[model samples]
Target: MSKDVQERGLEIRKSVLGAEYVEAAFRSADDFNLPMQELVTEYCWGAVWGRETLSLKTRSMLNLAMIATLNRPHELRLHVRGALRNGVSKDEIREIFMQVAVYAGVPAGVDAFRLAREVFDADKDA
Candidate 1:
């Protein structure tokens, strides 16, 4: 992987996910998961999110919809925080989950909403 791409990815990842979170993620990575961390930072964040085509807000919104559809609770929670950081409003998130309910099934929507609320509440307390 290009060092530039990896650097770009780390920058974007820290911006969207917060520096502390990204640092913690790296700090916790063992040999087993270090490569995955590097790949996500370089490719997922740098190669994809670093693109200029879409605004970060738009990307976060899309992620919310897709992750919700996939029913990936952990990622959904993480991205909910990222969405807020990327300027996605709680109202917009609600609408996305509602759309997911229609197309991805009510159960998925329910879980998405629940997870999003948990993030919101946690942020409030923090």
Candidate 2:
């Protein structure tokens, strides 16, 4: 990609994750994980997240719901958080998780909720 595109991706990654988080990820990258970090910074946040077609708020919510429904509790927790940081309200998150319970299956949603609450608790202290 062009330098402009690469710069755009870095900007998007910083915007979505906060400079601290992105910096930590970048600084901590070892030889084994360096490529993955670059790919995530350039692709996930750079390309996919940089797209203007969907608002970050909408994308975060959709990602949380989908990951939760898919039984990926770890990702669900992280994205639930990203959704919050993207301006999704706590009540809105509750609604999405509740909906996930109905359409995605109760057990999966419950586990996701369990993980989400853990993230929320940590956020409260931070």
Backbone Cα, N, C clashes tallied per candidate: 0, 0
Worst 10 residues of 2 by lDDT: 73-82
Between which residue pairs do clashes occur in model 1?
A: none
Q: Tens digits of per-residue lDDT for model 1 on 1-126? A: 799999999999998888999999999999999999999999999999999999999999999999999989989998999999999999999999999999999999999999999999999999
lDDT of each: 0.95, 0.82
TM-score of each: 0.97, 0.86
Model 1 segments more than 4 A misplaced: none
What's the CA RMSD of model 2 in angstroms? 1.7
Best by TM-score: 1
Q: Compared with the true structure, what per-residue lDDT tens digits does model 2 show for residues 29-72?
A: 99999999887767877788888999999988888888888888
User: lDDT of candidate 2?
Assistant: 0.82
